[model samples]
Target: MATEKRNYKRVMLKLSGESLANDKGFGIDPEVVYRLAGEIKEACETGIEVAVVVGGGNIWRGLKGSQGGMDRASADYMGMLATVINSVALQDALEKLGVSTRVQTAIEMRQIAEPYIRRKAIRHLEKGRVVIFGAGTGNPYFTTDTTAALRSAEIEADVMLMAKKQTDGVYDADPKFHPEAKMFTHLTYNDVLQKQLAVMDNTAITLCMNNSIPIVVFNIDVPGNIVKACKGETLGTLIEGE
Candidate 1:
């Protein structure tokens, strides 16, 4: 198959932890990881620098832990560790596929991965390595979505890709519940904010808005969608400034 012309030089891909889970939605699914890694490798082959931020919801939800009576900070820290596990799993899969990859965490864990250094991460990207960011900004009370936005800005990514597990694009309502929910092919950052779309958390959306980074929300389960997004093939919802 012929590849499309690329549109982005560098991009940040935001993935949910559930993306690595199986049908039961718990723990790492090696099949899922390998499939996702294959798609990411294809995107990287397109000459687009890729950095990933993965959520830890499948392993642990800090909010859920806190609500269950654990200290919020402690729970959040556990959540951060979950992200590191996912990051390493992804790194392993990508490397097996012959893609050069790096896992950097906001929380230092030199034995497993490098600590997040903005300049070093950027240098890795420039050298054609896929960088995975873990630990969600090394802070409590922030979503990995926010980490994606922050990392996108720091890496000067041309676009941010929000990879949904099953959903294809941003909809006006939960499409699963609302079959008639409208999917906007194109949207402005204010459209997302004013309408309170669930595309991303407000902090993540605002960071992209402030940095003028475009975002593509698409279904990651669909093969080749990642590369399509990198090529600007319009398979998903695009959000940017008006």
Candidate 2:
């Protein structure tokens, strides 16, 4: 069969830290990371520039800590550190597959990864190296989702690929609990906002909306889905301007 033409030359992949975890959802699973890396390597082979922003929820959740009475900033900093760890692990997995990769952290950690530099990151992507962004924008009170949005705009990505661990796409309600829920294949930014869908936080959604970057929200566990998403084969909910 002939391959479909790719719609995007560059993309920002938004991943939750839980995507790197095992079924227990508490720690990094080497097998899972390796599988994910292999898929990413496939996407790179297609010549698409892929950048990643991974959350740290598997290791720590800053908001949860703050809710438990910890200083919010300190807790958020700890969460950033967790993302660094996940980024390093993913970098290792990708490199093992013979894919050149770079880990850039918003918060500087000279010994572990390079500091985030916009121009340098774009250069790396241009050279076919996958760049993993860690540390969640180097600030407290910002999510990795927001980091993905911010970086996608700065790097001029064609689309934001949200590889969700939960549902395959945006739906009217939680499909897990509501079997009759409807999945939307496409949506407008205003529809997402007005319906209060949880596709992304409002700030992240607004950022993409303002910049006119399309977002694809899809399930990550299905094998080959990542490559399909990169090729724009239409597997999930697509959010863009009307």
Candidate 3:
């Protein structure tokens, strides 16, 4: 039987740190990670390249640290480290599921994982290895959302998939708090920017707009959503430029 054609050849999956937590609480959740890994493996089996960028909010929120009187840069660096930890956990989970995976850090810790190398990462994806980018661009004050946009551009991914925990898609307001908030099925970069949608930070959204990369925001709590997004099934809001 012939395999179904995929909408994207390569995709970048952006997952929030909280997504890895237990019961929507803090810290890494093994079951959640394993389930997510299974989904990723299924997507990989579809013959498309997969890459991921994970946030550090579950372990550390740099902005909150700065607000609490810590040095902004120091707090941000700590957040980066938190991301590396999440990446390591994810790498282990994916491997246990029989998926080939690599954790490349922007801030080098040669003992733990490989340093971020553009060509090397691309080569790994081409060979069917999932590349997880950690350390948040190795810079302070840059959110992992920007890291996802930057990495997606560098890897030339067909689309950037933003996986939210419970939210279904990008909405006019906080859907949880605002019962009347409207969900957008499709939007242009300008629409996201002008409307100041929280789908991503302006910097991240701008980078994708400039690079002509589209973004899909969807609820990851639903099983198989990741694979569905990779298959271009329109599971959520799609943001693109005209």
Candidate 4:
């Protein structure tokens, strides 16, 4: 029970849906998922326990439901399903690359994957298996970011690695739009919440703060960054911890 004896024994990684897609937001890109799998495989090779929370922005988003006026809960449920699709694609990609992975859905599709059971998920990680958590928190109106925080707390993950499509670190403004947005190499959770820095939803940020979890926000486009960041490399902004 030596706490796994890793530089980071447990890590919760969050990947945006767009990160898994190509230029068009239609389907999963095999190459991107493969590369991501490689990065995660390396981390596991180093004895780092991994769990992933992937988004579904590429496939769908609850917020963008047509003006026909879908209920907020219904739209959010649709978003949850979208995450399941991404999870299935990711699982296939990882297996293709010879990496052992599990997809646990909050919504419970036993034929496809196991339900999200806290003890079971932790056991998977303890066995050095990568666990992919899908379907958002089994709740509506919550983003995958909130799922990351909730799961990280439950599994006692050492860090939450948030992998973005672009922009390496937290910035004062969107670098894509504002050429001079100041990038923060480091920050506190308060900075993200109080300042409304937009790293994640207010609920997610508050959850991390309450749980005292450290978070690293970085760009996922960098092939090996997930592993590097897990080993405590200075790749992006570290928030909310000593």
Candidate 5:
């Protein structure tokens, strides 16, 4: 049986680098990447366009090593590379599964992927190709979450699906360490920012807040969750207009 088609003409999907791997939290996991690619393939077949923004936490996080004497610019550049690494993994996985994909980078690396081009990207999606956005907004001191927001606005996406490793929805506390954490099925953009939810950075929240882009936070570890979100299922926490 085919899944019901989603209403989205275009969507920006955010994947954490950790999703490319498991608890090891290092390199990309082949099986995980393939599964993700498969989901994306299905979504595209449903006639909904897809654009992706992947994070670099699995490779490196600027804040974590800021005290290690790394220059902010260099650390951020490394983070950007981490996103590229994950993007490449995703691209490869998708291609192997027969899903056409393009890897576009914020900071140009002509040999690997095309530099971010708004019109070209939209064209790719229009033609039913999946786009992987990497390099973290081409600037330092910005989270990839912010990159997703920036790119989503640039591409005029309908929604931003935030896929996490665990904890299917946004919560009041760290559900991993605190089992008593409460979940929010629906939340306002202000609620996320004022409450300082770790789901996204302030920069990202502000970007989405100003642009009015809806964000869906859900666990990617669950099979078909990506498709579920794309299909507009009321599964994850929705952060939008209050």
Candidate 6:
């Protein structure tokens, strides 16, 4: 693939924690990690800078923990730790595939990974290293989706690639439940907010809107979707400002 034809120079990839879980469910699935790494390696090899934000829902959901009576902040902190674990797993997988990668956490954890440094991360990407962001804002009550938006704006990415586990694109309703639900090929940020499409949280959507960053929501179940998205193939719902 020629680099000049690619639409995006740099992109922020948001991966759900559930995507990393095996068929049995819960915890990191090495197979999934390796497969994802392969796809990402293909994208990076195209000369596009890539940054990733992974969710921790497979390991822990702070909201669920809080609903079960755990302190909200404490539960959220635990969730952050879960993201770190996923980030490390992804970093290891990418490295093993011969892709240079870096795991940078918002909260300091010098033993395993470097602390998140905005300029340092940008430099890494410029040098052709993939930077994986973990520890979601280093704060409670924010989803990795928001982290993706925040980091995307901070790093000046061309688009945010939202990798869904089973969902193919943004739909009028839950496609899993409603077989006839309409899948949107293109949408405006306002349309998502007006319809409450649920492609991402309001904060994430609003952040992208304010930053004028586009988002590509696509199925990650397919092996090469990530590369397809990086290649600017029309394979998913594209969300942007009107």
In candidate 3, list every pair of residues with a backbone clash.
Answer: none
lDDT of 5 by residue, 1-242 (tens): 11233377898999999988777888877888889999999988888899999998888887677768888888888989989989999999899989899999999999999999999999999999999999989988888999999999999999999998878899999988999999898888999988989888888888988999988899898999999888777767888886
Residue 232 local lDDT, model 1? 74
Q: Least accurate stretch of 10 residues (summed lDDT) in model 1?
A: 1-10
lDDT of each: 0.91, 0.93, 0.93, 0.86, 0.89, 0.92
What is candidate 2's lDDT per residue for 201-226, written digit by digit as tens? 99999999999998899999899999
lDDT string, candidate 1, 40-144, tens digits: 899898888999999999899999999999999999999999999999999999999999999999999999999999999999999999999999999999999
TM-score of each: 0.96, 0.97, 0.97, 0.94, 0.95, 0.97
Q: How do the residues 95-140 of candidate 6 rate in per-residue lDDT, one tens digit apiece?
A: 9999999999999999989999999999999999999999999999
List runs of model 6 lying over 4 Å from the truth.
1-6
> Which pairs, if any, clash in model 5?
none
Q: Report model 6's TM-score to 2 decimal places.
A: 0.97
Q: Write the per-residue lDDT of candidate 4 for residues 25-130, one digit (tens) a residue.
A: 6678888888888888888888889899999998888888733488888998999999999998888877777778899999989998899999999998888788
Alpha-carbon shift of residue 151 in model 3 (angstroms): 0.3
Residue 221, model 5: Cα distance from true site in angstroms: 0.7
Please identify model 1 stretches exceeding 4 Å from their true place.
Answer: 1-6
Error of 6 at 83 (Å): 0.3
Model 4 weakest 10-residue run by lDDT: 1-10
Clash pairs (backbone) in predicted model 6: none
Predictions: Cα RMSD each: 2.9, 2.5, 3.2, 3.6, 3.1, 2.7
Q: Comparing candidate 1 with candidate 3, which one achieves the higher TM-score?
A: 3
Error of 3 at 52 (Å): 0.5
